[model samples]
Target: MSDLFSAAADELAAASAPLADRLRPRSLDEVVGQEHLLGPGRPMRVLVESDKLSSVVLWGPPGTGKTTLARLIAGASSAHLEARSAVTSTVKDVREVLAGAQARLGERGRRTILFLDEVHRFNKAQQDALLPAVETGLVILIGATTENPGFSVNSALLSRSVLFRLEPLSDEALVALARRGLVAEGLFSGGDGTTEEGPDAAAKAEFEEALEVLAVAATGDGRHLLTTLEVAISLARSRHGTGVSGEQIVLGIPDVEGAMGAKAVRYGVD
Candidate 1:
């Protein structure tokens, strides 16, 4: 009975989570895009694999995998991972994390990796509070920001960390990501819910066109792509009529446009 209830709770939590969060890559192999930083012998991969990472800043537009990379770094290393958003955290919070890191290092010799999301939001004083621990190697700081760190971050703190820039994903990458999301969410047709085989050839063609429309509408952000897909699927499901079955609610271009409140535009040169 307890096991059944636990499983039910887990299912409920997963259903409530955002599709983007649910689909976040679990390992470097599963991660799409950012090939330059994650490819063979890349500096980021080397740092994570060797667990010799130093303080670093990841600068990128929203949904470009800054937080994902930071989490990957912590998972690859033996360090205890701590996460905080600079938008909500204060100087006191920084001091607390540093104190905890100091204690862990002194007592258990365990390193702590601090993943500070939106680090550019931190004011100069709050950032200053983190300098001592970062400098002394008590904590490995992985700061992520959509803003330009060089302009938003304190020069002193910026100087202490290596910076990596992440670019917007390409259109092909966005299409692949949307397709993966469709399969993961079990919205795809066919018996297995993974294959694209639909009830008819027309449905399959519509599904493919819908995926393309979503890929273009996403505008290079993986999170946006997945979110749009999720909403489009839900909208399609809600409008199911007598002929429409659960498995027959495959998305179409109209559904994609309706969910996004705009038509898909051409992405690349003809």
Candidate 2:
């Protein structure tokens, strides 16, 4: 049946997606880092929850949840979200989004939130194209960049938007994120009825050590942490066999080191 084929396709796509993309926070509460901005009564949280968010620039290091926050803002708002990457988008893309925003507002009175990822990559002209719509309130622009917005963003656009700076995640935050990734990958029990009984105390300890190494090597980048975790999981599974058994796939320090290459040493000599 068509429905069965569609379901199969969806499963395949989900399986092929990166662990970071798959584990991305679906709601503001699920987001791991950026506490300063998402904390209670914070300006960003207040604006997002109240749905009164104006044009804003999220400046941060990679993996600090810029895109995640933007997505959450869009999710919290009644606006339709349109996401584009500056690396692949051009002035024409900006115009198209603006045009669509105009039509959506005119026809249904719905606001549009335009999320531009890696916005620093947008040249002057491309960035300029978004100004009219953003200034007129036709589109709520959420520009995310790993670069300093002050130096990269145009003055006009920067002046019109509130700038929220995101800091690198702390080690504790990165560890928590690693735990979440482990649960999402089914390597750790989720306390659900479907939990698999596996791994004795020794294996669990080894896994914990590996996780700590990964968290340290991640260097405050959540995406890098998850990616390394995924690679470590895969490497461990490959060496341990993929059969569903009572024993969990315990990853050792070597496995974590193998996943991260040179950066793994930052965790300290084994």
Candidate 3:
């Protein structure tokens, strides 16, 4: 009975998760955008494949996959992963992680990766707490920051780490992401209505046109693109009413415009 309850709770949690999270790519291959970082022979791809990453920083704009990439790359390595947010973490937190990492290294010959998100928020003293562990390889620091590290990071710490700049996603990448978002929302049909066997001709055309509008508004941010789609999907269900079994909910331009507060003028007559 407890096991069944546990499974039910897990299912409830997954059902309530945000669409963008639910849509997160499972493998590096499924990941969209960042081809420059993950392409064949790219530095990141090489490091992940070889499990040889050192202390490094990922610099990128919002929604460009900083946190996602950090988790993916670290998961590929053999080291134990510990994540903390600079926004809420303190010098004490940093010191504790470092000490634990030291103990782990001594006892098991294992490494720990401290993935510090929004690392620019860490003050000088908090960062200082990490320097020794980072320098000695007691912990591999994977710092992610939206701000320029040269200006925000300590000069000494910055020098010891590799920095990779992640660019805003391209238009093509955003489009692909929006399509995946559609499938995740179960909008086109029960199955992913992407190919010829998916949605009918007219429905697919409307879906493509609506996605194009979102791509323009997304401004190379995948998160923004997907959030809008999720809202639009909600608006569609609300507008159509519920309990309409087996009827595919179509997400069209008007639905997107409503979600985005876009005026009818934004998209001229068909």
Q: How do the residues 1-270 of candidate 3 rate in per-residue lDDT, one tens digit apiece?
A: 999999999999988988888887767888888888899999888998999988989999999998898899788989999999999998888888888888999999999999999999999999888988888888899999999999999988898898999999887788888767767665663234543345577766776677778888888888888888889888878876776412366677778899899853344444
Q: Pick the candidate with the highest TM-score.
A: 3
Clashes of 2: 0
lDDT values, one for every candidate: 0.84, 0.84, 0.83
TM-score of 1: 0.88
Which is better, 2 or 3, measured by TM-score? 3
Question: Better model by TM-score, 1 or 3?
Answer: 3
Write one digit per residue (lDDT tens) for candidate 1, span 1-270. 999999999999988999899988888878889888889998888888888999999999988889888988889899999999999998888888988988999999999999999999999899889988888888889999999888999888888999999989888888788877767766664334454436578767767777777876677789998888888887877766557644556777677888899876533326
> TM-score for each prediction?
0.88, 0.88, 0.90
Indicate the worst ten consecutive residues by lDDT in candidate 2.
187-196
lDDT of 3 at 194: 40
- Candidate 1 stretches greater than 4 Å from native: 1-8, 189-196, 199-203, 239-248, 266-270
lDDT of model 2, residue 36:
86
